[model samples]
Target: MIPTDWIYGLIGGVMIGAAAAMFLLINGRIMGASGLLGGIIDGTGKANMKERLAFIAGLIGVPAIVYFTIGAPATNVSNNMLVLLVAGLAVGVGTRMANGCTSGHGVCGISRFSVRGIAATLIYLLAGGVTMLVLRHGLGVI
Candidate 1:
């Protein structure tokens, strides 16, 4: 039998896909988190400040509201601040180099059958698997 968590995951994935579709159709923009946040930070999103702000607000606010209402979700992240900071910076740089992130490449890009998106998604999955193998088994640092 399918696990309860798998059902929840399926529902969440559907919701995310719907949200991405709606964002693209209504805003005429890809719902990429990295691009959205980067544009705001770099002042490139000034022309659509309201829309960007609304998107960001919803992104952050909805999760906070959900956590408060339904209780905080569990995480298994390392407590090391430096490790977290380095990881965050690495992801930022990687996304900038790739021209998009998981949301853009995996969801929006793949849905539109984009070559770049498919390539980036594959690279991301491969890199993630390698990282996990190295960290969890080779280094025992995870």
Candidate 2:
């Protein structure tokens, strides 16, 4: 029998893609989570505070609901406080520098054929691949 995990992932991907497409079509704005959250927190989203709030709510709420209904698999998240802090900081810096997160550039932007998004995606993928290669393989961390 096929593993349920792959099925769940496929379904999740479809849902995310459809949601992103619908959000863009209905709202006429790119659905970038970081931008949405950052704007609301920094007051830049004041113009569409309601919309941002709803989006953010769904982002957090749906997962919580799913967890209650169907618990998630165990994660391999790090327990090291310093590593976690550094990783979080690095992601923040990287996202700010890139102007969007992977979902924004990869899923939404790529689907729309956005040049900036394409370039940003390529750069980040390369960086991430190299980092993973070094950390997981070269250093034999894994």
Each model's lDDT: 0.91, 0.86
Q: What is the lDDT of residue 104 in candidate 1?
A: 87
Which residue pairs of candidate 1 clash?
none
Q: TM-score for model 2?
A: 0.87
CA-RMSD of model 1: 1.1
Question: Candidate 2: lDDT over CA atoms?
Answer: 0.86
Please identify model 2 stretches exceeding 4 Å from their true place. 1-7, 140-142
Candidate 1 residues lying further than 4 Å off, grouped into runs, are: none
Task: Give the CA lDDT, 0 to 100, for residue 15 in model 2.
Answer: 93
Clashes of 1: 0
Determine which window of 10 residues in candidate 1 has minimal summed lDDT: 69-78
lDDT of 1 at 94: 90
Best by TM-score: 1
Q: Per-residue lDDT for 103 in model 2?
A: 81
Output the lDDT of residue 10, model 1. Answer: 97
Instruction: Count clashes in each candidate, considering only residues at least 3 apart in sequence or on different chains.
Output: 0, 0
Candidate 1: residue 124 lDDT (0-100): 94
